[model samples]
Target: MSPVFSASAEIDDGHLHVLITGEVDMATADTMFQAVLREPAERVTLDLRAVTFFDSAAIHAVVRLAQQFPGALTVLPSRQVHRVLDISGLGDQAWLRPA
Candidate 1:
């Protein structure tokens, strides 16, 4: 079966709440990346609680977005997602939250 991935964003409390679901592999990472790029908010919070699986591509996409936005991005990753961020050395970035 083909991997499924999707992301949606909403602005709340002066921040963009991005909800991501499904597996985040190379094929689907771009959808998440585009969602982040399209958000027009001062801050971004990514909710990854529903993400079942993720790969380096997803990690890199988040890192790239954080770099592009500087102090404007925040990641509210689930426990499992946190592990991937930790392994990618991106947990130390200022934008990563709930660490």
Candidate 2:
């Protein structure tokens, strides 16, 4: 089956905010990944409050983004999203901030 997902982005005050919804898995990682990386900004915040599902591939994409931006990535996640991040072993990642 195909992964059900969609992403939208907006720029505000020199920052990029990306909102991702649905399942972020192998099938949807490339688009999601590229969308966030397509533009450069002073900071990038990924809002995952509406994400219903997220897999390891999505986790990897976030990791790559963190590595590329260093202290420039922040993630806003709901409690459910936090569980997914925790289960995927990113709960303790220093750069993965919750806001």
lDDT of 1 by residue, 1-99 (tens): 743677888887778888998898898888898887786778888888888888999998988888877988878787778888888787777877773
Which 10-residue window of candidate 1 scores lowest in summed lDDT? 90-99
Off by over 4 Å in 1: 1-3
Clashes of each: 0, 0
lDDT of 2 by residue, 8-83 (tens): 9999988999988888888887788898888878899888877777778888888888888789888887666788
Instruction: Give Cα distance to truth, residue 19, candidate 1, Å.
Output: 0.4
Model 1 alpha-carbon miss at residue 95, Å = 1.4
Candidate with maximal TM-score: 2
Each candidate's lDDT (Cα)?
0.82, 0.82
Per-prediction CA RMSD (Å): 2.1, 2.4
Model 2: lDDT equals 0.82
